[model samples]
Target: MHGTIERLDDSALASARDRAWSIPLDEFDPGDPELFRTDSFWPYFDRLRKEAPVHYCRDSVFGPYWSVTRYNDIMDIETNHAVFSSAASLGGITIRDTPPDFRRESFIAMDQPRHSAQRKTVAPMFTPTHLDQLAINIRKRSAECLDNLPKGEVFDWVDKVSIELTTQMLAVLFDFPWEDRRKLTRWSDIATTLPGPDGLVATEDARQAELMECAAYFKRLWDERINEAPKSDLLSMMAHAEATRDMDPRNFLGNLVLLIVGGNDTTRNTLSGSIYALSRHPDQCRKLLENPGLIDSFVPEVIRWQTPLAHMRRTALEDIEFRGRQIRKGDKVVMWYVSGNRDDEVIDHPYDFIIDRARPRTHLSFGFGIHRCVGIRLAELQLKIIWEEILKRFDNIEVAGEPKRVYSSFVKGYETLPVRIAG
Candidate 1:
């Protein structure tokens, strides 16, 4: 029965590999967005990890970049920020290069003193004390969403549960208007989407227009909050904070994109992934059902199992030789977190969703170094609460159909996941 399920689960992947081998081994382009959309990029990374851990692609749609496939190699690059810069001036943090005119600066894409100063502005919001206070509300909302799931009826979990929960939390954090909260989701999509026929935007021009609208709307909020006294919400925090208070239009917009995407995508996709993965591994799901105490371990394992963001790009600051490969200055280096999480050398049974792994937290999903996800605690809290509430409410969330994955290589998220609960 397990073998049957496994074969059925990997049918799409089996077909994708057939086409994936058409490209020459040396010229393999792992950044092809279509490979991700079809859920067929696994084999490509597997080959890279074995053949060329520090492989370079001379050409891709996003131009030239190096793929760091192994676990240690990625950490080596991620930790040395002095050598691998995340600045927007040096092409930002995605395989896609930032256009000269459209270049925007956010702390995630900045280095040193400026990055430290800007990061400090929002650091207090994710502290243990603040998260503890937020936990009460998180549990309340999670319960409400899970309890309200329609019994014996199919629904898109990505929209109703995953997107709904993450959207609500973001709204509360930013004190954004409740009715207009979905705009956050739209802007998050726009900010990350590759402009193309197959992707989010039809043209670069339309992408910029939507971004301008996002900037103008936030500018209004900034204008209002700058006059008022300090408050705890993210908008007010930025408005009153010294470093972010006087941000230019582009800088303000860039930070908003970072916050929205960070706050929404990672936790949201993982929520959907938990249900999907559990459905695939009935043994683990049964174990979880029998022992609700496993929620603590289960959450982090799911984050690693579903590596929400596949990779983050960093530009080499100077000419250097890494792993005997000549890496020149101004070169783009991408850390494949998805591949690293599945590296068998570092993780035991790395591909399996082991809910009770001994060291569940040992993965590259949150990344390494100073630029590690600022909202890691908040994300874990949201996932833990949702699953805790889920166990109290339902025995199973059946995967009604194959999930539709997002087309972009950067976001590495679900477009929809159909699920149904028992009556």
Candidate 2:
């Protein structure tokens, strides 16, 4: 039965690869959420990296955009903030544009002086000293969470482990209410989800309504934090910081959504991805199990392998020529970090899931330049500590079934992954 399922999956992928090649270059909509959900977007990116590298799609559901596919090219665009803008007014950092009325200005969505100011408010949280303090709490929670897992039975690793731990961490970071912590997960999902009958919310209006609720809830917290003596929590830091304390309503909500999604999704998805990656590459799993010291390297390799949050979009500031291609002012440019992570020219044997790569951190999973993920160190710490605990407990954790992936092209993540561990 397992072999038949594997063969069927292979056949479907082969067929998808054929379609990817047969389609006209201009018709390629690699950013389509459907492709990511089905896990059939690999061939499209592969073809683009080889044939186009810097291709433009004249029409997509998200409209016309440029895709930068190679690793070096993505770095070039990521670093050139003067030419490429991440402004919320310019459609923000995703291929899908937020309507002008709906636009929210987060630090990642803002460029330069303002961006640096807002981002610095939360910088103290991820410092070495802070992470050392966080590590003790992380390990305790990870052990408890793993200990409670149902052994000798199938369970969704995504829900039981990934979402649970990351949500807990977010709650700690914000000093949020314990019972209401899952609201962070819900808001994070709602922030990135595309509005449809099948998505988290059925319409853009519904999505915005939920987001407004999130804003209201956080506003209450902001009110509390602003009055208190300043502390280490993210809310208090922002409430006390000069740059963020007096932010406008939309900017406050935008930064709230940014921090929630940033602190929740990337680490959560990568946690699930690590299990799936190891399940597929048992040899690497064995290496880690035998010599647990490899956790340092293993954490990063899995991050690179997953490349959670597949791409980041930047709007061209002005008409500029890049790598022989003419980019016009106000163009929406997407740097395909997913494709760049697998670019053979930059990473040796990019397709493999080797845990001990000498340069595991070479990939662009957290992105590059000034707009890189602020909580990156904290993310690595969570993954490392969880695995350290996981290795100490289970001899084998079997992937009982295939993973159900997220529908959004932006958040590369597992919705569910059935797994079993021996009793």
Candidate 3:
């Protein structure tokens, strides 16, 4: 039964590859969310990297934008802050542009001195000493969560494990109410979801309403935190810090959404992805079983393979020519980190998931330059600790069905994943 399923999946992917080649280069909209939802977007990016490393789409749902597909080209674009801007006033970091009135400024979407100042407010949370402190709680929660799973029955790994653990971690970081922690998950999903009948919300206005609710909830927390002496939690850090204390309403919400989504999605999806990856590559699973020490290498390889957040966007500050392609000022330039992770030139056998790869951390999953993910060490620690606990408890956890992926090109994640653990 599993072999038949594998064959069918292979045939579908082969068809996708054929279609990707048959379509003209100019007609390709690699940023299409449907492609990511179906996991058929690989071939589109493969073709773009080969033929048009710096290609421009004449039109897309997110409007016309430039794609930098190759690994080195993306690094160049990521580092060139003078030419490429990440300001919220200029559409921010995603391919989709927020309306001018709706735009909010967060540290990741800000450039220069201000970005550093705001980001520094929460920097202490992810330091080595702090992570050592966080590790004990992470392991305790992970062990408890794993021990509670039903054996000899199928369950959604995404909900029962991934979301539960990551949301718990987010609650700890924010010192958020334990009973209301799931609200962080809802707000994280709402912040990134495309509005439609199929999405989290039915319309843009509906989406905004929920986000405003998130803002109000956090504002209450912020009010409470400000009244007290300085604390180590993220909310208290920002409330007491000079850089973030006096932020405007939009900026406050923007930073809130940024921290929420950053804390929630990346770790959540990658936890789910690690299970799915190992289930498909049982040989690597066996190797991991033999040498549990490989958990260190396995953590990063899965992160690179998953490339949790697919792409980051920058607005061209001034007209500039890059790699023989002319880019105009104010153009939305998307650096496809998803493709860069799979670039054959930089990574050996980029398509394969080798758990013990020597240079496992070479991929662009966490991005590059100053704008790289701030919670990177904490993310790795969570994955490593979970897998260590898993190896201690279970011999194997089987993937029972195909994963239902998120319908967003930006947030590469699983909505659900069916799995079973043998009794």
The model with the greatest lDDT is 3
What digit string (tens of lDDT, one per residue) describes model 1 on residues 1-423? Answer: 011133235566677676555667767989999888877788898878888889899989999899999999999998898889999988899999979899999989999879989988999999999999999999998888877889888899999999999999999999888999999998888888888887678998889999899888888887888899888889899999889999988789889999999999999999988888887888998898899999999999999999999999999999999999999999999999989998999999998889999999999888888889999999999999888888887776788787899997888889998777888
Better candidate number, 2 or 3, judged by lDDT: 3
Quick one: ranking by lDDT, best first? 3, 2, 1
Candidate number with the higher TM-score (1 or 3): 3
Residue 83 error for model 1, in Å? 1.7
Q: How far out, in Å, is residue 268 in model 3?
A: 0.5
- Per-residue lDDT of candidate 3, residues 1-423 (tens digit): 011123137789899999999989999999999999999999999999999999999999999999999999999999999999999999999999988988999999999989999999999999999999999999999999999999999999999999999999999999999999999999999999999999999999999999999999999999999999999899999999999999999999999999999999999999999988887777888889999999999999999999999999999999999999999999999999999999999999998989999999999999899999999999999999999999999886888888899999999999999988888
lDDT of each: 0.88, 0.93, 0.94
TM-score of each: 0.96, 0.98, 0.98
Q: In model 2, which runs have C-alpha deviations exceeding 4 angstroms?
A: 1-8
What does the lDDT read for residue 117 in candidate 3? 97
Worst 10 contiguous positions by lDDT, candidate 3: 1-10
Tell me the tens digit of each residue's lDDT in model 2 across 1-423.
Answer: 011113127688889999999999989999999899988898999999999999999999999999999999999999999999999999999999999999999999999989999999999999999999999999999999999999889999999999999999999999999999999999999999999988989999999999999999999999998999999999999999999999999999999999999999999999998888887777788888889999999999999999999999999989999888899999999999999999999999998989999999999999999998989899999999999899888878888888898999899998998888988
**Candidate 2 local distance difference test against the native:** 0.93
Clashing pairs in 2: none
